[model samples]
Target chain A: MPGEDIVLRTEALQKSFGSLEVARSVSIELPRGARHALIGPNGAGKTTLINLITGQIRPDSGKIFLEGRDVTQMDVAGRVRHGVTRTFQINELFPNLTPLEAVTLAVCEREDLAGQFWRPLTAQKAAIDEAFDILTQLQLADVATRPTRTLSYGQKRLMEIALALATRPKVLLLDEPAAGVPKDESAMLFSVIAALPADMSVLFIEHDMSLVFKFSSQIVVLVGGGVLLQAEPDVVRRDPRVREVYLGQAGYV
Target chain B: MTTVSQAATDPHSWLRGQSRWSYFEIAFWVIALLPFYFFPTYLTLASQIAITALFAISVDLVLGYAGIITLGHAMFFGLGAYAAGLITKAGWGEPLTGLVFAGAFAALIGFLTSFIIVRVRHLALIMITLGLGFLTLELANAMSWLTGGADGLRGVDVWPIFGWFEFDLWGYTAYSYSLIVLFLGVVAARRIVHSAFGLSLRGVRENLTRMPAIGSPYRFHLQKIYTISAALAGVAGALLTQTTETVSLETLSFQRSADIVVMLILGGTGRLYGGIIGAIIFMVARDQLSGMNPQYWYFWIGLLLMAVILVMPNGILGGLSRLAGRRS
Candidate 1:
């Protein structure tokens, strides 16, 4: 994998909020097809890093590179077009609109058909087809016609991922994709996320250790606004620091 | 799961399912046509209703679809009124071109102000819109040479509709002209709301922040909708000037902006027909009530507003849906 191109990279990103440093010289990389986890405690600034990566907020000093191209100055929409996108921990969806309508809009956005106003939505058959395909992939096709608000919490979570897929991002960021979902649906949700197109690298944040270790091939543990460790799951599991500070396993290992 | 792929291959049927013409929609339009036959004497009021309905629809686009409420929407309306009046006074007397000029002029101003509007939200947005409205009113009053000031634009001479059918004292030509324009505006608006762009406009209203994640610029969408709404509102104003043969300061007043909002709330927003229905009821109520008891008309209107709000929090269409046991 040495010659493989990295899909996403961050260079010594520095950010602080008043007296507290949220991101301190934090740097990480995801190679093509990487499924990486971002794990941290309550104040580890995991969400902050996600916000910075997705260009929702700017960092004080740092650079973000997507597919070897610098994208630090890019806005959220610019970053999304450049193949980097994210799903929220809290569902951000069009409550009154059906999933089919929402997903079709997402496809239209990618194809620049959003300005097609003279014709009806039915005329965008190709975009709708593509949207349904994305919905089917996320197992959201069954509830596609229902208003997004009426969907089960699990289905709603999947809908978020379905929308992210419509962007066709090269790197997908998941901020607790399984947060608040029922246990049974949570596992299914993770599986669907885990099985996203192989070429699209995933960077996810999770507080659920079991889900993290079970799904993420690699883990980046953030502590005190910095990367404490970035390694394979086994290495992270065996590390005394992670075991003590996060796992809280004083004697098991 | 089997149904999933089938829908993936066929979205046309799914789209058709949502847009099937209801009996109510057809009947509504058919009823709108009846004023031509039955309301011969009240054609003046009918024409006014049509013009105000068009204005309400324009405001509906911003508040209902884009979720950007404004207290200064009358600025566009007034500006359009003035444009048509000024153009007619300047010898362009062609009605259709006057309408187009008015719309474009207001749209230009709308586009410029949208940059300021879309950048803020909630209370701040409302204040900015109110400020814009006041500024427009003062501008109209200060520039009395062109606008005719508080006395109104005196020499707005509108040409015959379609180079035929001159406006008359009985209000036949004016009613027909305004109604036709309003109908065309409705058709155009319905097409827009059912388009991919229109759905995205709803998306902007529902979740502004989420749009960027899908590579859609939220601010750009808001600005576009605002400009469009402004343009339509301007056309409605042009209709007023063309029909009445004058432009008044009241066209740009704070009251005009507030009244449209009230009308939309009464009819329901988002649904394209809400503004139309609301305008009819509000205008008709004003006429009938003022004729009977001019000074207390406001009291009755206030009462009606309270009752409507209390009984139907979502307005007429929304309340109707609820009564039918359907979630709108």
Candidate 2:
């Protein structure tokens, strides 16, 4: 199933923090339009893999290829511009900006309008429209004009995804899309995320196996910083090793 | 400066409010212009306040809006002073051109140094900027032949507005010219901070790491704002040189840089008008205190600053806005 349509590929990624090996020869591939879920127990280096793929942290050894081009040497912004983007588990959003303004900022950034000082924001009608559309899609259109800080926890978390979507990323890495979200809102959040464009590859880190089993086309179970199994939802659910990894963990129901 | 409805019908309407004039803003500018006609004797002091306010605004752009904590912004101000003074001393004394040239000169230096400046953050950034300020001061002092050394760059001659009005002793022309420039600077600064670029700057300041995920490189935005801030500061410095006919080593002094930071904090940060209000409050307090006790004026100024800060931690303007918000 490893096709030429892979949008993101980590070739034998290895990282270590002193004596602690967080990622040991971790390799993963995300094909175009793939709905891949990265499921693992706590301290499984799920976030570390996302960080390496998004250029937030350097791997001790490996090559990160975006659309088959090596991007390991690139910076975070450079990689993002080349169609790699990620959302934080903690909801890293601009508290000072409205959802519309924040999303417009991302769209302007995507279109490279961030440098245009002469034109006012009103002049970027197309970008603003696109930003509003992204907000609408996220069901954040009702509160689009309110300050981001005033939004509910669920809404703010969705705003994070809105920002990622505004970048129009080819390879979207969601580091636990519903980290702090309540159980009821988590399903709704995943629904919005699951409705993202088919042409965009999505790799999400989710502890909620229900969402993972429900929304993910494939699941990659990570254990001890290494890929234990990469297969369909049923295969991952039936794997005994995967069961052992999450035995004591709250994630395995 | 902008307000949008929670349920706006049109997407473009969100930006429409930014262009509309606020009554309070108009009244503020009008009151700023009133001092020229009402209190002519204080015009010289008023002009100096305008220049200082512009300088403080420049600092605000870099530190407040861009989230760059700099302790040595006087480097650009001093560079502008010397550039304007030297250009006039070279026999071309066009006031408007001097302002533009001085701003450009400072911007050039800012852009050149931004490579090193934009790469650092927090305490390291503060030290590097302070180091840069000191380097400029020593360089200017060392080049006494060009800058007139400790004696100050003297004989800075500025021609009248369109060759009609001279920079008189009463400071009629200086007050008019400085106010106009300050007004334009405020307008331009307001426009920049409210634009898409400015919005992104706020985003960068809010979360430097988050910008990359959205595809806006933080370093380049910082570089652009830093350069723009330097240009405004240079223009302010050039205004001082042109109006006073002198450029001193103190322009680049650490005290000058430190003072603007105080004024910004005393007034507010992030907001554009904070700097101007801070300059006025500080300059007025200094003037009144110095007159009462010339030798121990610092004590009084320090006391007054502490009182203001203790009461209004967000600076005078920020506190006032919060009060107004509560009342409304």
Q: With candidate 1 superimposed using the best TM-score fit, by how many Å does residue A24's alpha carbon deviate from the native?
A: 1.2
**Second chain TM-score per prediction?**
0.95, 0.96
lDDT of 1 by residue, B75-118 (tens): 99999999999998888899999999999999999999999999
Query: What's each prediction's TM-score?
Result: 0.96, 0.96
lDDT string for model 2 (A1-253, tens) is 5467888899999999999888878888889999999988888899999999998899999899988799999989999899999999998999978888999999999999988776888889899999999998888887888889999999989998999999989999999999988998899999888789989999999998899999999999887888888899999899887887778654422
Give the Cα error of residue B61 in candidate 1, in Å: 0.7
DockQ values per model = 0.65, 0.73
Residue A244 accuracy (lDDT) in model 2:
78
True contacts kept of each: 0.75, 0.73
Cα lDDT, model 1, residue B259: 96
Off by over 4 Å in 2: A1-4, A249-253, B1-7
